[model samples]
Target: METLANLESFVRSADHGSFSEAARRLALTPAAVSRNVAMLERNLGVRLFHRSTRKLTLTEAGEAFRNAISGSLSDIQAAIAGAANGGGEPTGVLKVSLAPTFGTMHILPLLPAFIARYRGVRPEWHFENRQVDIIAEGYDAAIGGGFDLSPGVVARTLAPAHIIAVSSPAYLAGRKLPAGPADLAELDGIVMRSLQSGRIRHWTMRDAAGEQIPAPLREVFVFNDPAAMRRSALLGLGVAMLAVPDVIDDLESGALIRVAPRWYADAGAISIYFASRTLLPGKTRAFIDYIVDAFKQRRLAERFAGSLG
Candidate 1:
């Protein structure tokens, strides 16, 4: 019988198409992973991967074997994790991916309380600005907006991903106050470039009265990251459109002032995503519950709604 380690090596190698990447995920040496896979292939009496110097390609039999065992393998791993935790108490490394600014501002603040409550679960968080594959990358969960729901993953919304225009008080001091979104074009704009599309992002601002207007702020500065755009706006360089959750504290502290207060953009909901497994690991479940409950208790959903502005 193949050991779990061997199966894991094979699956992760197949998932990543590289022994090095699988080794990185499994915290094993590339040689070890390759050896484990070699052992599995020897035991099965069939070559699984067509190996080249650059990448590992699955053979027909290997593809069939992977398909046969992928779902069962996930369930087995989850079951093993659940069993290791005494069937209830959450204990393990909780790997999570999060958008940098939102995670630092909102989710990171909740960590102290989370760790205090579930001391057994150690958080391994990656603060990044891109969407991650939850299962393929071995992430327990991820927090962000606009994730394409892959198979075997579910998203639970935590707050509205509403966006609003903001600027430093010093920058707005001498400028004419905008009455509507169209007037924003007269001001210097701090804009974000889409990392995926390589285009400057623009939004249509909508009022509660159902009126929509194009926000065409003069593009004086452009950045690839939202955090940089927010920083530029905070420096009184220009007006920036930023997510409410990101700039809420700055707005509350009078560092950033809302421009055209009645107008805002509806992006979507900020959501926590996890695998839709029948047997979820206790640490992941605990994290999901804690974050969902905290958001409700704090009423962050209402506060993040840009339409309320």
Candidate 2:
């Protein structure tokens, strides 16, 4: 029989592709995790990982074994947590992944109230720009847009990720304001380059009247991150197509103004993602409920809609 620690070490190591990260999550040393995995491999009589200096990859047996035990391990952990927390109270570290600017501006404000309400739940948040593997990486939840719904994961949409062209008032001072999406081509563009593919993103703007037009702003500046693009737009660099949620505050504060106000692009929905398990952890449930309630109270979906522009 395999010990729970060995199984946990193996699964986490596989999820993160490194023992150091697994050790950090487990609060064990890398050497300890490595030894636990070694012990498990010896008992199983098969090597699970193809260990290399740069990467740790799962063998065929390792992948199959991990798939077999990962869900069971999660369930066992959740059961243990439930029993320890008196079966109801939301307790333990609620690890979540979030986008940097959006999380800081929008979600972080709700923390005080959340902590006050659920005193036992501690938030462990990672502000990142990329989509994370919720189950594999052991994240309680993730908040972002355009995530592929992998098996055993589910998403609840919080807001429309409507993209709209924006520019600083200073940048538009001497330029002819765009009358429509087509006119946007005359202005200098602060465009986004996809970090994943290294390709420039092009958008088609839609009006409230259901009219669509190609948005081809002359590319003057390019960035990989929306926050960086927002900063550049603020510096009077050029017009940028940014997610409404990311620039709502700036728009409200008059730091950034919508270009071709009648038109916008539909990016997708900003969603909260979590593992789809039969029994969710109390902390995870509480966090999800709190965030959903917050979005409702704030009417973020309506506010984030670009059609309103």
Candidate 3:
């Protein structure tokens, strides 16, 4: 394999017009520079520089190779330094921004366990319901849901958001249960209006053919909070599209019934994202692993399954 050190030697030798001079500049012997350049040329099976007794000049191939190698060498050097610092123990404060419902219900329950595992890093978390600029807000990491992340961010999937329509059996007992997605129009429902938007959040569903279709829901009561809508649905008010965890208790206790399978689409996975330009500290990487590990080891899988049913 060709070494980056050989490419560096060749680049230096061409610039200074002599192997001896380049070696002197790089604190190496002339023979070392010659071996590096020779090995590089042998590896590529092409001459990089035309050599003579009087002067040195680049072959057409030499100029092209130098241009490619120069930029890559700079990047390699920078990556090495960054990896060393970024992969080591993180000492400074790590700032994270996460969604409110996810932060409160999912991530917050996960923090203490991670904190207990790694003692070297301290995290400062900011939770908000409204969307904000991650860079402008100075957050190093962010947890986002079904929303599309900005072009400048690097995203990784954490878990999925499976929003389902559920209602109390008391509410559906005498009433006709919607057999199809369109039938939701005939049922009384508690709709969640997005606080960001003035309109109510519609119940969307899919079929075995993978067609995603939105079902028009007649809103008997509109609420901004899913938790509140879940509360209303529990009292036998109406069916509501709620996050799985929000209704896991009621579903397990046989208090709520899953409604209209046609409206339940493929799972929409929630993601954890970070600024692309920023290098993640070791602690940040570790925390991501730690959270994923806890998700598996803990009964999160069982709970999610029970909730989904």
Q: Of the candidates shown, which would achieve the greatest lDDT relative to the real structure?
A: 1
Clashes of each: 0, 0, 1
Ranking by lDDT: 1, 2, 3
- Let me know the TM-score candidate 1 reaches against the reference structure: 0.90
How far residue 101's Cα lies from its native spot in candidate 2, in Å, is: 1.5
Pitting candidate 2 against candidate 3, the one with the higher TM-score is 2
Query: For model 1, what is the error of residue 151's alpha carbon versus the real structure, in angstroms, after optimal superposition?
Result: 3.3
Give me the runs in candidate 3 sitting further than 4 Å from their true place: 1-88, 211-213, 296-309
Evaluation by lDDT, superior candidate among 1 and 2: 1
Q: Whole-model lDDT for model 2 versus the true structure?
A: 0.93
lDDT of 2 by residue, 101-130 (tens): 999999999999999999999899999989
TM-score per prediction, in order, is: 0.90, 0.85, 0.64
Candidate 1 deviant stretches above 4 angstroms:
1-3, 28-47
- Give per-residue lDDT, candidate 1, residue 130: 93
Please report the TM-score between candidate 2 and the true structure.
0.85
Instruction: Write candidate 3's Cα lDDT for 3-30 as tens digits.
Output: 9779878877876778988888678998
Select the stronger candidate by lDDT from 2 and 3: 2
| Model 3 lDDT at residue 66 | 81
